[model samples]
Target: MKAADDSYVRVAVLVMLSLSLLAGICATLIHWLGPVHRPMDLIVPPVGSAIFGGLIVALWRRPWWLQGIVRLALVTAVLALVAPAWFYTLQAVSTPGVQLIVVLPPVSSLFVVLLVMVMIFIPGRLAFVLALLCWLLIALPVLAYLLLHPREAWTPRGIDLLMAYGPVSLIVVVLLPVQRGMAGTIRRLASERARMEVMLHRDPLTGIHNRRLGERVLRGVFDGARSAGVIMLDVDRFKAINDTHGHPIGDRVLQAVAERCKALLRADECISRWGGEEFLVIVPDIDAAGLHLVAERLQMAIARLPVAPVRQVTASFGATMIDGADSFDSVLQRVDRALYAAKEQGGNRVVLMPVRPAAAGALASG
Candidate 1:
């Protein structure tokens, strides 16, 4: 998340620098072509344009110096804006009548832009403090001058500038924190919802999908009319193991078996803790041979692993392929019966059940 935020900041910096460079160029062009031209416009615009262009090149060459460059750019922008506003206001105060052609309108709007940048680039309370200082530095002088000269304050231009630097700027500064708070809330809620969803579908002990999720997946496969392999795995003599080594050891054994089985399966396959001492494995797009192979692999995996206190831990697996005619209950029953057959034949074996004729017909028809 921090890296993502840094990336966003870097992109923002590049865009702002490009825009500043463009604005400078346009301002210089306007001064050169317009009827009313000040010497300061030619000097300041060209110098500012050159500085922004240099900053852009520096940023492109040394991207890692983003933080320092951003700070410098912001400081320069604030000075560029505030200095003009102050000069124009001071000039107006000294003159006999209202200087209707002052730079207050654009400068006031740019202060708002600066405040927005401050909010985005700076973190925590510091951003708010910086915005307040920026507002005071620029707005105070203009506001004081307007109040003292009521005639100028009453004019349309005066009112527009007054609103821009007064209520408009203050509103932006005040509401930004509220907007940030709302965004933070949305992110936190989304994170929490994802966590809750994981908790709902995952078994706490083995950290595998719970029966609920397994059932949902099975239902989806059946509804989609897709062929799949279902394997029911039962830990051999789980009760005896619990009785001999206590439940904790039994739990560890279960966890180890789950891990081993999961490692053996493909990404498309799912293994879930169906209930106590039993797990359900779902392998999509598999035939009887493939299904039997998967079951054997799981059986071998469980038989080979030794869970500490016990020299060996084993499980019996009953495997079957889905048939078109098979209902959820029918499939589960067949897999359960196959698992029982494996256990009866003496646990730690794989038993594969073939599709029944009626189910085969249903499958063919489907």
Candidate 2:
């Protein structure tokens, strides 16, 4: 797991680095053009944005430090980009003879505003604010110099380009990552919901469907679906095992019994721990006669299951088919009575529910 996680982190970082490099190229071109020229390098924004998007997906499951490292690397990339541009501007200042290329009047800072909006949505508040503060701290001296001296640095054309592109750079930084964060958060929430559903429906100890789920599945099967049967199983002498060998071993025995039952069941069947030492089995594709064969096989399967030193770790099974006269409750009551009959007749036997007619049908027919 760690190796896979590390690989994902490396891939995410690589993607982010590649995007940053592309952004650097676009920034260089933007600076290369000056005086009210438009940003023809529109392709760079999306490439950079996608790289950041990939990084967010990769880092979503990574350790906190890896996420921080990615962010820090982006900040460094920004500095590397802006620093060289300053040098380029300085050279332009000394050479009065050089003619400057011009683009749409600088709207860099305006771009940063849009980025901030994105950041607020994606990276969450803490990360977005921390990043903004870091950028502000780094730019404090430069911002102060620009404010205190407002005197233009370098060629008239160069300063105008900075005025236009600076905000765009900031906006791009904030917006790109923020959008990715929003997507990651949504994905995370969906995953959590799926996991919660699984937990609610399954038994943690036995790794089988729980009682609540078993009933729901059985109802669906009987309501409009296939012919079905209910198999109520009780581990014969299970209470004796708990009394003599202690609860811990008894718990293990229960777990063992559950696994054995699961092994015997078809994929479409469902099993649940009905209560202490008892279980409920729902077979989806069987009728009353078909279920009798299942009960015999299940009884044999229980005999085969091991319970440590105990020589006879067997279970009693009582099954019933849902006929026209029975509701779900009536079926359950009949099955319970059948199970009691098996125990009373001597343990480890399969007992089937007795058929009976409904009074309403008799009275109406009469």
Candidate 3:
């Protein structure tokens, strides 16, 4: 099913643009084998999309440029399909009674594009059932026209639109149900797999990436970037909060801080819950000094949020960037040590680890 009516209109435009080019060319080749080329054929080719294209333009109110292109392409397709019949209509041999032959028109090509539209844009049983109804609707008209006017419908230089084209459309629509069912099953499976993957990575209590997954993600980021900030964060006096507010309230506080940190993590950030009351984060572009800025930002985000029934909550953060070509593992170890130092000094304060003598001096000042 279409997500909305606007989406249906866009899909219709794309379908017309894609299938018309291919089907129009095919129709041109097939009808050339017929006889009796005519002025009408040169003028109109084989008007398939014209009817439906016009319908979309009127119903959807598609953009003027798209409508213009649709009108032009549909006209071109009709002209291409009918081009072969230009001469024969004028050269009809007179009969004692009138030498007559049987033929169908060139409505087959239109049916082909319409079938593709149903397959691509529409979903489920509706696509198949509606397509079947349309097939019969278009098929009968071509069939009747071919039956009534055999000489015109099927000539050596002409089209046998109904008799030749009708059955092909009916068969296509009949096949749609199976194809639609298969596609639905595949999409559902893929969506479910993705949902499960997300569940596996998450900590159920805190809704944060679990330690293993978070570590994996941060390691990848640190390895990929030339410079990055590794920050360790812990909820301030989390034990005291748990003791005073109860474990349920403590869980809520942890959940709130996790959400704040997650929001702070941009496209190049990876953050996860390292353990109870602790979180780990990696920011790809930050240097040692820039790491301090990032640490401060996380501190603010944690402190700013309004968690219901918990008036005052804050997080202490410690950050360090790799000093001169250190391995990702060493960088993490250094940063995590710095985090412990911050907790020892005072709760709710940001601490920075010195990667070099200059950084050490800056940390003392901080």
Candidate 4:
């Protein structure tokens, strides 16, 4: 189900459980305080309240069990509403005086509650239909009893029942379409926003974070860390591969390189396709030795296997550890110089750059 639909169902569950609990408490109180009354009046409310309260607790603690709990609620609600109406209709037939016919049965309130529950939990046209059917089933038997015995309709109880059942049911039914429309709109908007975000921050070809997202992540890493590692890598002889084969094969090689590097890095590390054939990596809370180990692992992982269609491929890596004093531009310049040195002498090697004052820093090959 869509998130909006699931949210509506949860809201419905909470509302039904809460109202059922309150109704149960009131019914139990009425039985205990009021006259002896009907046998069911005493029995049903306390049991119903206890069950509702238990279900609420289960839902709060284990939301994963929602499907089972909702099924139980539906069955319980049907019985709670239908059983009472059936019992009261039988009582009206045999009993005497205003007790059965006065003030429209309390069952009407229960009917409305059931209708609200179905409307919110079940979505679309089906929910509305179920609400209407439930109302008919619960109300039909009592309506028939009043019709068969004309004297019963003349009483105040019959008029109150008509008033509660007529206008209230109509209003609740009307609201279903409105709720469905609003939920659908919200789901559509959420989906679109997610699609736009992916397009904006993700690389079209490699399915890894693009340069834009990498920069944003780098800023976050820089803010939080005292020392961090920044590695710049370039595929050796990348242009020759493109010329020898084709751009499609070249693209596949890039994707393979990304997959290999991603597998070897920790979760907190940020890796992105810095540009065509060049990638940037940021590892926070890492020292010079840790950064060198990471760079060596990446160098071996890429050079060990010939990514299909290219008989052999190797990458040159330049890594440096940054402290509180370094600026982003300064770090990039240092790593770039290391990358240039690696490519100049040999391709399959790792170079470590020392970070010191601009004049003091020196490059060392690893």
Give the best candidate by TM-score.
4
Residue pairs clashing in model 4 are: none
- lDDT per residue, candidate 2, 1-366, as tens digits? 357657775675665555555654565466556344323334334445455555555565554556565665565534443443343334434466433222222333423433343353234566566556544543433343344334443547446545544565465665667567776797689778988998998887777778889888867765675667888989888888888988888888788888988888888888998877889998776766788888888788778877776676888878877766578888898788778777887768888775453331110000
- Give the per-residue lDDT of model 4 (tens digit) for 119-202: 766767788778777877777777777778777666777766665567777787787668767867987898899989978998
CA lDDT of each prediction against the hidden true structure: 0.83, 0.63, 0.64, 0.80
Task: Give the candidates in order of TM-score, highest first.
Answer: 4, 3, 1, 2
> In model 1, which runs have C-alpha deviations exceeding 4 angstroms?
1-87, 90-103, 106-110, 147-150, 154-156, 222-228, 243-246, 263-268, 284-293, 322-327, 354-366
What's the distance in Å from true for residue 186, model 1? Answer: 4.0
In the order shown, the candidates' Cα RMSDs to the true structure are 6.4, 10.1, 6.6, 3.6
Q: What lDDT score is found at residue 351 in candidate 4?
A: 82
Over 1-366, each residue of candidate 3 has an lDDT whose tens digit, in order, gives 335545655667666655664454455455655576544443343454354445445535645455455445444543443332222222333223332233224555655666655655556676666566555554444444446656656664225354344566666666666676786798789779988988999999878789888778766664564677788888887888888879999988988888888877786787788898888887777777777877888887788778767778887777777655676677777777777777777757777877753435426112
Better of 1 and 4 by TM-score: 4
Pairs clashing in candidate 1? Answer: none
Query: Tens digits of per-residue lDDT for model 1 on 203-275?
Result: 9999999999999998888888668989999999999999999999999999999999999999889999999
* True-vs-predicted CA distance for residue 39, candidate 1, Å: 8.3
Candidate that scores best on lDDT: 1
